[model samples]
Target: MNLTLASGAPRPSQTFRTVFPVLALCWLAVFFDGMDVNIYGAVMPHMLDDSGLGLTPASAGTIGSWTTFGMLIGALTAGNLTDWLGRRLMLVASVTLFSVGSAVCAVAGGVALFGFGRFVSGLGLGGLMPLCLAMVMEFAPPRRAALTTGLLMTSYHFGGMAATGLGLTLAQAAGWRWVFWAGVLPAVIAVPLLLKLLPESPGVLLARGEREKADAV
Candidate 1:
């Protein structure tokens, strides 16, 4: 069956199921990206108070700049790498990079190490958004592509709010390190599902001359 309406647009129900694996996984990844990005801000007050770390206002700003610099580098490089590597692998790698970065932050004892962790996480955070955007757009129903993109973008805000909630609750309770530990959840939770369920991009496959594989997807 065509599984579409008279206008030749796929029904929302059908379209959703067809793309759900990719869309859902991408949404989850982007959500983590947002959370990781904002978590620093959320935990800043607590971090400043921790005298052992020696975090000053000037140094904090410098670390923030390092993160943004890393993000800029990551964003610029990801597109080139994606062309050679494909979206699925790149997305997985990006998630792993950020999660590992979070772990580093969780264990960091000083300003230098913490700043490095943020920079590392920033690389993955920068790379992830474009990849997720590309994946969802590729899989979304034609007529509803804009809506799907909008929906995917909203997850970032939700993730940010979640970070704030965690800052208020978790950071206040267990400590800021534990909150960053929570940032590692995406690697543990989403990675296995993404590897098993997410399909490779058909367009990328075709571009790489895997026409049969592309067709199968």
Candidate 2:
């Protein structure tokens, strides 16, 4: 079905063909976002047990706050950056930032370093969800926008569950650091796919007066 804007120009309603690629990629990114976010909580107990890291309950809480603070900063800035950088770059950067942050956490020798890592990851985590939601909404059928958003959010929970499962198995077997290493997987897995397959947002193209590019998208 074609939709008509207020200008009476017909806008193409994206079918599953166009929608699925964006949806799947966005979903996978969100899944990793969720996994990375929850992995901290899942492995917190083990972190506290490890004496060398010096993670006390009070410091742990403070580190968590740092993560939240970084998230606030990232969330506030990401939308503005999206206008200039576009969704694909933002997504790629966000994932890479978090993955690199996770690697930092994996190697962190002390509390300060670990907290800094969490904060860095928080920035990426905050940016990723909104970018993904916006991307998916742009491509979804108008009538199905809410449904697609709902579907995208489900990956987050699944990812959290996966984090829990990893905490249960990998943390116990290898160590908490290994769980953080696992957090790096999203960048390794999603970045290549997103760069290859995800289309640029047509709305963004149009906003930039690149109507021909927008139409191609």
Give the candidate number with the greatest lDDT.
2
TM-score of 2: 0.94
Model 2: per-residue Cα lDDT at residue 212: 99
Off by over 4 Å in 2: 1-14
True lDDT of residue 209, candidate 2: 93
**Residue pairs in collision within model 2:** none
Model 2 sits at a Cα RMSD from the real structure of: 2.7
lDDT by residue (tens digit), candidate 2, 44-95: 9999999999999999999999999988988999999989988889999999
> Where does the lowest 10-residue lDDT sum fall in candidate 2?
1-10
- List ranges where model 1 is wrong by over 4 Å: 1-14
